[model samples]
Structure formats: structure tokens, C-alpha cells
Target chain A: MMGDNEEILQQAADWRALGKGVALATVVSTWGSSPRPVGAKLALEQEGAFIGSVSGGCVEGAVIEEGLKAIADGKPRLLSFGVSNDRAWEVGLACGGKIQVFVERVE
Target chain B: MKLGFLQKALAASREGRPAVLATNLTNGLQTFIEATETAGDLTLDAAALQAIRKAVTEDRNATIETADGPVFIEVFNPRLRCVIVGAVHIAQPLARMAALTGYLVTVVDPRTAFASDARFPDVVLSTDWPDEAMEKLKPNRRTAVVTLTHDPKLDDPALSVALRSDAFYIGALGSKKTHAARCKRLQALGFNEEELARIHGPVGLDIGAISPAEIAIAIMAQITQVLRAEPQSDREAA
Candidate 1:
């Protein structure tokens, strides 16, 4: 009954119901050469289990780390990544774009 | 147990209904709107309600500004459908092609032999009369209807039903002379020129197609054209 994104969100809920903590990261907005469009999502579980993508391999690892943190703290976090900074190259935003992702624990 | 707005939206989506879900980002309050049904128990301010209706019509997803701040609107539309009125040679390929392109294809014909499972392997088959079949199908804006049955009793009834409905596209297979005769007959039935014009007789683009497969290709191309192009621009191009 769910669309692609909703399906992933449902998975998050299902996993949480099974006693695994889960966090959802959603692309709230993006600018200039961002690989994933806005509303793209990624869900991560407490045990390093994850599904879906927020970005094309560029920032998923960092987002997953943030997702895990969100699952632990039970608070939402807004993350911003851009290629303008020197550390962007190491984090995979080499496409000269900026993206704002909102990470929240799914209850 | 009561369902939340998200669960209600999911149920409506699975049923292929036109639905919109609007969420106030700050407060997380949600409004679920089913375009075809009554507003039911949900209540919202005029601005939010108007925005949701607009999003449903446009099939657009967006962030809307309301008195209560920004609301994220997600729109859900049913999958596209193609109802072919004849299980003829051209329809064989047409059904396969439409299915390949993500359409839920249904082949309708009263002739049981032609509408057999062997002919339309994966397609939905209806062996009822055209009018009865069409009534059951209930062609809507998301549906495209093509009549390959040359017989007036068969094709005419289906064409009339489609023309009256909001079906996005209506096509009929025939030659120019045959089309002229068919149009004249419909005009006798009190259909005005504008209504009659909706029928794309001698269906499909002018692609110089001859074989059944080629004709099916042309028909699918024309249906896609009508779907994506503006009516005025399509007329100009035609």
C-alpha cells in the first residue's frame, strides 16, 4: 500500500517494532548538482542494517552515521553537506553541490 | 482500530484513488484528501485545503506556505490503464507494448474466441459486450481507450462511452472513408462536432505503418503524444 519512499519508511517501522532502533534521513532540500532529488530517503537500523539512498554513494556513509546517532539520542538532526568546504572532497560531495538532510528517529 | 492519515493515504493509494497528503512540518499535523470522495471528518483552513486540491489536480508534490507555516504535500495518482476494445491482430502487439510501458492493459471483446487467454496471455480479458465491459471498466482520466473492432455495434458503443467520460485518449481503427461514415453516424446520435472530434479515428500517428506490429507501435506513440502534449499544440501538429 506504500509508494517507494513509504515502503522504506514502513520497513523502518517494522524493524523498530522488532526491538531494533531505526532512524530515517530525508533530503529536505538540495542545490546545484545534487545527485538525489529532494524527498529521497535512507533508513538505517541500530545493527548497521540499512535500505534506500539519500545520495549517490557520496554522503550515505555520513548520513548513516548521523542516522545511527539519531536512533541513539531520540532527537532529530538537520545535516548540511556541501562541496564548497575543503572537507567536502573527502566526504564525497565532489559534485559541487549542497544538500540539507533531516534525520529523525522513527517511532 | 483507527488508522492514521498516513495509513489511510496508503490504503487509498493501493486502491488507485487520487489522494493527497499534506503535513504541517512544524506541528506534524496531517490532512488526507481523497479527491473523488467527500471531505469526511478532516478539517483544514481554506488555504491548506485549496493547496491540497490544487496539488491533486496537477499531480504535483510541493511545499506550500500557509498561515501555520510550510506544509509538505505529497500527491498519489493511480497507475495508468489501457482498455483495448478489440482483441484483434493489432491489439495483440498493442497490449504487449502497453504492458511493457507500465500500463495495466485490458482487452475487451464479446467474441470469446478472440478474447481467449492464449491470445492476450498476460492482459486482463473481458468477453462482455462493449457497453457492458466499458461500464464495468469506468474509463477515467488515467485510462486510455482504443477500439479496434470495426463493427459499428461493437466499436460505436465503446467510442460513445469513452467520449463522454474523462478518458484521456480515445482512438478508433479504420480507414478515412470508414471514419467519415462512423462520424456521420455519431453525429446522428446528437453528438456535436466538438464531441465527435475527440475520437482519433484512423488511430495513431501518421507513421507510414503497414503491418499489425507497426500499426500498434504508431498507436502507442500517438496515445503517448496525446497524454503528454497540450491539446492545442497537438491540434497544431496534427
Candidate 2:
């Protein structure tokens, strides 16, 4: 665990060891002014529980709900945010930052 | 389910096992790397190091087959760390410098007076023998070992172990004349010329350092040079 996604992998391992269905979300790329770093992680549990962080604070709730669905369905997803002006404001994204988040099921 | 790869890499690193991180930065996929773990009590050889390095550089993350997968590795360097074996006047500044350079530094010595918390305020002070204390420090690809005690009893055994480990930098603080005599003794004890050559004696760069702080700066510079595997001349000027 020495790369950008090292912490994500570590968090995934910790969650899995707890007998939980965990989904790992990574901020693969980002543009403009964003609160979270590029490699920020978000872990969503099967019951809609969550740990770690992706964005600063914007869209976490929506992301968590989406993540819970992914875990319940046992499917992976790629989520995008803040590309357009209206899309950015809906999620409270500042400076119109665009980020691609990859959500993969880790069981 | 198959998380052993990540776990083992971190565990090996936490336990001071010498491991390298290989990152593959390319388009489409994310980071790509194929890091290898050195398993066993036996120290890894230079060939093994080269093999892992080759794996890191050759891991073209530009693209992968649909079945093969995307980027596989990212980042080659580990958490920067260093174990200073000897709590001397110079050790104090060296430990502090190492910490600032992102090294989790540990200063070891049998003398409590020298290895006191007051002297090494920023360092993890260990009053154990040099050899025993390094176990906690756990040298790795990201770790360096420096002998500043200038005591044979401490450095002799410590060097034996440090040289055999995967520490990327091994330096000893002593004058050239003192090291010449020390080298003779080490050779008598079975250390070959090649093994003895690894040590960077007179421990530091060409900087004309007279004070303890300056010496620390020079030594750290030497270490950075070693860690990056780049010639000192090629390093970007600060």
C-alpha cells in the first residue's frame, strides 16, 4: 500500500475483515478548485453506512446512497460530478471542478 | 478476497521488510506497478532489487487487454525512514534533519545521556544497543542506517547487520583514517572488499561542513541522492 490508492485498499481490507460488504470509491481525477485530494477515498457499507471521504463535503450523501445501492446490487459503477455549471451547483461543487469517481465492490 | 498483495506489502514495510512500490502512471488506466515482496530472513540481493526496479519501469500503463486489466501499479518509493545508530552530538541534528525529510527517524545508543529525549527532542530515542535497537527501526527500501557513535563495539555489529539488510543508504561518521583502521578490522572478521565498499564513510557530501547541523545537512543530502538512485550532480539545486 504505497501508491495513491494505498489508503483505499487499506480501508477496504479493514472493512472486509469486519464481515462487511464494502465498496471503494476513488477520486480518479479532478479539475478546478476541489476540497479533497485526487486520491481521496470513500467506503460505503452494505447497509448504507459509510467511512472515509471523497469530495470535501458536497455530494457525499448522494454518493453514499448510490454506493449503498451498488453494494446491495453487488455491482460496480463509475460516477462523475461537476462537469457542467448546473450539475456543479446541484452538488455544491465550487469552481466547476469535475471529478470521476470509480466505485468497485470489494467483498 | 485476494487482498494479500496489499496487506503483505504493508506488513512487510511495517516490519521493516525491504520492499519497493512500483507505480505505473499512464493514460486510460490509473497507476501501474508490479511490486515484489522479498520473503525470508535472507537479505535481498542487488539482482532482486534490479528485478523489482525493472518490473516498475517496464510496467507500461498506457493500456492493457480487456481480460488483463487496467493500470496495475503506482508509486515506487516507500515511506521515508532512517535509523541512526549512535546518539552523538551529530546524531541530534541528523535525526532532526531526517525527520524533516519525511523520515520516521529513530536514534539508538546504549548511553542514556547521549540518547536522552532532551537531546533528540524530535527523534524516537532508544537506549538499547545499536544492533538490538535497529530491529524496531526496520530498515527497508525507504530506510537508511547511519552509524554516528564512532564506537567499534556498536558500529561493528551494527554494520554487519545493516549492510546485510535492504537499507538503501548505509553511512558511518568517522574520519577517513579512523575508517581505514575500522575497515581493516572488519575485513579480519570476514567482510569482503565489496561488502565494505557499500559504506559511505566520512559520512556526507562534499559540503564543507564544520558544525553538527551542517554535517547533518550534508549527510541527508547524500541520503537523498542514494534514495533516488540519481547522481548527485543530476539532482535539482535547492
Candidate 3:
């Protein structure tokens, strides 16, 4: 199905349920090649799977890894990817590009 | 039915749930839209985007009315997120713009000095190695990645990571020369031509932007464009 519409429906329900807190992550900028567009989203919970994205498969582990700290700190964040080949393979990046992820905890 | 999908999807996405709505935009759009229901809260109150939800009948192939704006449901998938790959000047404006659009924004950088709270007062600033950083910041269908730094080292590697995932939008910043050079390098690194097409280099819309703020607007415009996947007919009407 449509990616955003699915995400939107879930977001509305989450809001309706009055989830503890909502955090918004955005892909503000990029270099080289990449997946997701800027302004893409991935919402997180206190402790569970998340919605949205910042990079391809390569950088998600890093994002979720960081999301944990973000929820604990209740602050927002800015993340980055790099232009290295070894790293891409490590995270399964198909293209050689860099990305920046901005995470904000919606108060 | 127009408001049905949009309203329902918005509600679901906010709840950390998932709902798929369909619209006619890209290829295979009809098949996908039909997969999900055109449903939403009966008392939905999206006044601004409301005009876009009218339907001729709940019939399939019914045209989406986007004369007012883009016609795509903001699906209720998971958490709303955005991944910023660089901590540059243009990114500063971009991060703010993303937040305004209701995305959860995270900025990443390896240089602690460049990625300090002082630089980005309101965001989650990380000073970790980018390669290692992306490992934890993996993206899904709802994810988006933008590489702001133009350096091949920073930008290229990050893109490699993004390309391997299902992120919705992937973009890079550079001129024709820079992009050409980048393509050459990527081609040499076992990248197929088709995979490269997913990238939006010379990042941002061609809005004749000059300043960081203007460029930020262009970038946001492009991002919104990809996220909505608005149909050409809707644009013509607008």
C-alpha cells in the first residue's frame, strides 16, 4: 500500500490513544546517493519498534541505537551517515551516499 | 472517500499504528490504494486539507481531488522520523523546516565540535562516527535520508548505507559536475545504474535558491513532493 498513508493512519491513532510522547525524525539533508527523501519520518516508542526512516538498511541500527538514548534523555538529535565503502557493506548500504537525521521529541 | 483515507491514515500514524491508504500518483498506485480502506474517524477535523478529500463516489479509479493541495495519505505506519546525515549550515535550516512539518528529526555527525548542542540547540545532536552511526539509524519505508555534506567521504558512504534499505526518499546535494563525479565514483564501486536513479542529487527542487534559508525551502519542497507523490494532474490544477 501507500507508504505515507499507512504511516499517517497509524500516527493519527497513536495521537488519539494519547501515546506517552511522540518524537519526530526528519532527513534534513544528504550527499552522494541515498534512499528515503528528506522529511521522511520514523516515530519511536518508549521501548518498541518504530515508524519512518533516515537512510537505507545500513544506518537504521545506528538510528534505533540512538533512539533509545533520545527517549531516555527526552531531548532531540541530529544524526549523520558517511561516504565510506566498508561502512556501507557493514550496514548493507547499496549506494554510496551520506545522510543526516534530525530527531525531535514532541513535547 | 477523499477525506476518508486521509483522515483515517493521519489518525493511525499518530498512534504508532499502521494504516495504508491509496491514491493515484505513481505506477501501480491504483492497485495499492485499493488494498487499504478509504476510512477515517467520522468526526475528523482537518479543515485546511479537507477540500482535498471529496470523492466522486467511493469507486475505484475515482480521481483524487488535490486542487487544494497534494493528494496522498500521511499513512499511519509507525513513528514519524527523519534522518539528517550531516551537520552543515544548510542542514540547520532544513532541520527546523522538517520539525515544522511534524517529523521526528535527528541530526548526525562524527565531529563533536561540528555537532554540538550549541550549534543545534533544539535537536538531538550526535558526535559518533557516521558509518557506525547509521548502523543504529536504519530506515524503513517511512524513513528518509538526506546527505548534506558534499565530501565524497562523508556523503558517499552514507548514501551507500541508505541505498541498501527501504527509505522513502534519498537525496544528495551537489552541482552537475559534482553529481557526475559522484556517479563515476559510485559506478566504479559496483553500483548499478538503476539503483543510482533512486537518488535525488543536485538536491532540492530547482527553485533558483541562493541563500541557506531559500535552499532549505527548496529542500523541504522536494521532500514534501516525494512524500506526497502528488499526481501531475493535481499539480496542473493547482
- Per-residue alpha-carbon lDDT of candidate 3 for residues B116-222, written as tens digits (9 for 90 to 100): 88888899776666666777777776677888888888888878888888888888889989988988888888788998888898988998999988998998888
Clashes of each: 0, 7, 150
The pairs that clash in candidate 2 are: B21-B76, B23-B74, B23-B75, B24-B32, B24-B73, B32-B73, B33-B73
Candidates in order, interface RMSD in Å:
7.4, 7.3, 14.3
Per-residue alpha-carbon lDDT of candidate 1 for residues B78-165, written as tens digits (9 for 90 to 100): 7678999999999999999998766778999999989999888878999999988999999998889999989999999998888889
Order of models, best DockQ first: 1, 2, 3
- First chain TM-score for all predictions: 0.90, 0.77, 0.74
Query: What alpha-carbon RMSD in Å does predicted model 1 have with respect to the real structure?
Result: 6.2
* Candidate 3's DockQ: 0.04
Worst 10 residues of 1 chain A by lDDT: A1-10
Task: Count backbone overlaps in model 2.
Answer: 7
In model 2, which regions exceed 4 Å deviation?
A1-107, B1-72, B75-78, B135-138, B230-238
Q: How much is A35 displaced in model 2, in angstroms?
A: 22
Error of 1 at B160 (Å): 1.3
Model 3 misplaced stretches (Cα beyond 4 Å): A1-107, B1-75, B231-238
lDDT by residue for model 3 (A1-107), tens: 23453463366346525655445555555555667654456666666467766666667777776766766776656666776634555564557667666554544
